[model samples]
Target: MAWGANSRSSSRSSFRNSPFSDFGSYMVVKNRKLQEQFNAEASSSSNSCSNSGKPLFHGVSIFVDGFTVPSSQELRGYMLKFGGRFVNYFSRHRVTHIICSNLPDSKIKNLRSFSGGLPVVKPTWVLDSVAANKLLNWVPYQLDQLASETHNQPTLSAFFALKSCAVSVDAATRLTDQMKSEAEDPLLKGGTIKGDNLS
Candidate 1:
């Protein structure tokens, strides 16, 4: 049977039948460790003479949205590549409050109910920074000028995916030209463009 984007959303059965649909739980727990640490520190510091107050969850968190990647094969491949650490941390019971950004309310509701069925009573990882920076810079994004209609192939997507380290082609080209000029200086002269991003 083929699964559509809305499949696991409506019924608890669909959710239970699929393992990957519940994978977000793992990411949720991973986000909670720091929250627990912050709460603990707050309790101690509030009682002591350390009057300097600090905000926990640091006033903002990495808001993420989830989409059922085209298929489990893609999902598993994503796991092989980026989801290992994200999945492993869900083993902890303290994690709860997963905040998924892209998923619709239907999917969220199904996952919520599933968590309710678990043996442990930890709340669903909803709207919380339970997961740390595990996927901090490793999350996925769309490639520029690509159509989302086609399935993303690892070979092609790896080359075009947008990254946190992205730079403008002009800026990049300029930097390359500067480097080439420095390297090809006259035999009697020398040039070194030190510490400048673009020179």
Candidate 2:
């Protein structure tokens, strides 16, 4: 019974010393460090922005989608500095604007279907607003506008196809006109050229 107890104690000790056991503690420490770093950066940016008078994005909260030009981290810093809310995860109720460089037509349609007319603007809107020290109209920066414009414009292949068809029609018209003119010519008659002999 004593030997059995000792064996059990050794197994417990071995389990405690296992590499897998350290993973949980390591994750906790890492998370804590990341939280502290984030807090420090946020506070510093907010402090700097506070010195610049009123926050440009005071009441606005934005959610970023996919990849962006200035990167999510840089945008987060800008939001903190300008007194805007930057949500890590997207929530329609909490987010006032969606920032994205580009979204596919399907994704744009999906967003429009459920986004309830949420203003999806480019990152330049934020940057330009920061530069101007005032929020610019989001209409000019709307992603849907771009999508609509692209949809309305003819594609390269379609344009080329139309041009080719026009050219073919013009060539056919010219050939028909030449045939009529040749038949009407008094110098040539009975399927004979003016300069040719029928032998």
Candidate 3:
């Protein structure tokens, strides 16, 4: 159901539709004293996951039509069951103004139950000094781009695992022309994860 949220109904905007969808009004939190207070208040609450001011839930941008929602909801619930509280990794007490970043449009505000629920401080405060919000918004597009490229490339590594055997020409073809080169070089050059050296 669409609430008072953004109309960009794509997967990127799915959060805009939920009742708890008013994250726009929220900003990333940074004040150490405020976080400490927030943590103290929530520490007694069940299902509360305040990791010394870290938001337990790290939003991963994903897409979903109605049919895709059931699985999403199931996974969401499952994650929350395991203490998946939302977290903003850029907290200040960590000796930096920010840590890992998100998207650029990331707002710096908090949106919670203006009615009566315990207010949820947005983690934007810490996320500010970086592209964290921008990264958040960019992730989906990047993954989609990767998948599209993966579908178009050709290689042999795709078929072989660390066991040093081949799977299929189509699969391996995807490894080089499809997946590897598709990613930014810095990422590919970083380590074995991107390098075929795994096998």
Candidate 4:
């Protein structure tokens, strides 16, 4: 019985030291610490914003659509922290900017048709502003609509993929040049391109 108990104790010790052992517990502890740290930072930033008496986005009302990077909730938290109002619905006159990573043509048209010419920006605008401790210009953080084969349709990829399709060198060069020009143009920088025919 004593020998058996000793053997069991050794086995348990070996298991504890194994590569896979205690992984869950280790992660739990690490997560707790990270949460604590984040909470502390958030509290401090909130205090700073309040104390400043001039929040970065005091007058700006924002609406989010199709944001995937930091999540809508996370974006709201940042906006609220800096005294910005987050709205559930998009208002042409009331909402100043629409933040989105993805958008449909109907939604884009609705924003564009607005008399105010509502600016549509990417999620990085919020994140970068928070990091800079000020409202950086949204112009640089804007997301451009990549004109694809479909008319007035925006997609993540600028060119539609064609499996085993061969293209002339001149066509490829022209396509590359056009893409480069689009990227550099300030007018086409925002979430939606304004032209009636972009491609």
Query: Could you tell me every candidate's TM-score relative to the true structure?
Result: 0.19, 0.52, 0.19, 0.46
lDDT of 3: 0.34
Better of 1 and 4 by lDDT: 4
lDDT of 2 by residue, 60-117 (tens): 8888988999998888888878777777656677689999998887887787777777
lDDT of each: 0.37, 0.79, 0.34, 0.69
Q: How would you encode candidate 1's per-residue C-alpha lDDT over 72-133 as one tens digit per residue?
A: 23322222332121222333243222323244457545554654432221112211112332
Report the C-alpha lDDT of model 4 over 53-110, residue by residue, as the tens digit: 6887777677788755888888877766776767665556557888888777776666
List runs of model 2 lying over 4 Å from the truth.
1-41, 47-52, 144-199
Top candidate when judged by lDDT against the true structure: 2
- RMSD each, Å: 21.6, 11.8, 23.5, 22.3
What TM-score quantifies how close candidate 1 is to the native fold? 0.19
Candidates 1 and 4 compared by TM-score, better number: 4
> Model 3, range 85-187, lDDT digits (tens) per residue?
2222322223111111222222211211111222111233222212242222322333232334447865566544633544465578877776657465655
Candidate 4 RMSD to the correct structure: 22.3
Error of 4 at 171 (Å): 32
